[model samples]
Each structure stands twice: as C-alpha cells, then as structure tokens.
Target: MIGDPKTGTLQHARIEGVGHEGLSCSAVDGRPLEFALLDPTTGEIVEHGPHVAQEAFNVARQVYRNVMKGQGWLRVLSEPAPLTARKAA
Candidate 1:
C-alpha cells in the first residue's frame, strides 16, 4: 500500500518489474495509483503505474510492504505533479 502525499489516501499496487534503473507497477483499483513509482537504484520515487483489479493490487501492496521492510527504507509514497495547460508566452 502507498499513501498519497497530498491527501493522505492509500492505495494498493503490484510491482510488475524492478531494477537498478527503475520500477514498474499496476494499481489494484482499476484506476492508476496516484503515487510515484520508486527507483531502487536511486532510492527515489519517479513514476506511476497502470491499473489492475482491486484484489490483485491489494495483494501486491502487501507483498511490497514486506519487501520494503527488509530494505530498511521509509514506506511512503510521493505524489505526482498535476498536468496543466500551458499558454504561449
């Protein structure tokens, strides 16, 4: 489970892939998780993941939580920036 920094909301997600460069995931709610995906190599949250079944996301989140505990890193999620329209300067 990841917590949204903006609203303090939590969501479930599954780690689809992990590597030094970055990590990929899918959300369990059939709607993308609002937290940034973490890059283990840099130890930073950088991107978001796709949507998946709620049940799957929940299970994946639990597994992720356990893995995180072993890594000795804070289990917090970063919020992604909101997109906005740009005006010609």
Candidate 2:
C-alpha cells in the first residue's frame, strides 16, 4: 500500500508470483503476481496485470521514494549540519 502524503489518497496493491493466482484476489500471477492498482477511496481498479508488468511496479515504487526524498521526508540523519558564524565563535 502506498499513499499521496499531500492528498491523503491511498492505493492498494498485491503482488504474488506465478501459481499463486486466486490466493489473494489475484486473477493471474504470471510475471510476478496478480498486480492491481486500486484506488481505495473509490474502490476502483486503476490498472491491472498481465498488462501492468513488473517494470511498472518498479517504476511506481521508485517514484514514491523520489517523492519522499523531494519532500524532505527521507533525509539522512547522519549528515552534519551547516556551521554558522556564531557557532564558529
């Protein structure tokens, strides 16, 4: 599950490998899983696989990570802070 932090909108997803079909409401599990992009708010399916493919899922996951980094939500805590003149004194 992933969400738009700014909008509070959520997306539900399921990924299961081949032969796991119908286990978790998955219709087909060929490439990886029965992949479905669903809008939780409207209970609608935005997209589904065998058409959506694993690459699409990888892109989506990377996009979410990029968004978090852009919003300063994934900052690295180990980095040193900038030194000011007052601190130098």
Candidate 3:
C-alpha cells in the first residue's frame, strides 16, 4: 500500500504494482505527497516488508524518493511556484 490507495491517488504513477510476481503492491503519489494533504485527505506510506531480502525496502525507498523529487514536487515547493499556465484563446 502506497500513497492514498483508497483515494485512488496511487493511479497517478501508472505503477499498477511493484515487487516480484508473488509480492506486488500499488505505487502511490500525488500533490499531497509533496505536502498538500492534511490528515483527512492524506495517507501515510505503508511498508509491506521486513525486507527479508536484501536491498528490498532500501531500493524502493530510493526510487520512490527520486520520483517525488524529480516530479512537480521540486517546482511546486519553490518560492512563487512554477506551474502557472499560459492560457491561449
């Protein structure tokens, strides 16, 4: 369980699932993930492993973190923001 599965935010990644064939889970992310969600609208990260296998959670953690940082989170948090749209008529 990642992101807000119940809220369907997990779909944004198009991840569908992670891990091996027997142990896969949905990947989750959203603007709230970048600090926009309050307790009511946000879900905490859920770990599905004790990492019986080496480099399991560690690798996943790195990957997930990178995704968030590389995505709009970096721009969204910057001062004045950087996502305003240029409208055309």
Highest lDDT: give the candidate number.
2
Ranking by lDDT: 2, 1, 3
TM-score of each: 0.22, 0.28, 0.22
Give the per-residue lDDT digits (tens) of candidate 2, residues 3-63. 5435323244343334323222222332234556699999799877654555454444556
Candidate with better lDDT, 1 vs 2: 2
Q: Global lDDT of each model?
A: 0.48, 0.49, 0.37
Candidate 2 C-alpha RMSD relative to the actual structure: 16.5
Tell me each candidate's RMSD, in Å, in order.
14.0, 16.5, 15.1
Which one is best on TM-score? 2
Instruction: List, residue by residue over 60-85, the lDDT tens digit for candidate 1.
Output: 56566768679644344433335553
| Pairs that clash in candidate 2 | 16-32, 16-33
Candidate 1: regions farther than 4 A off: 1-52, 71-89
lDDT by residue for model 3 over 9-32, one digit each (tens)? 544533223444222233244321
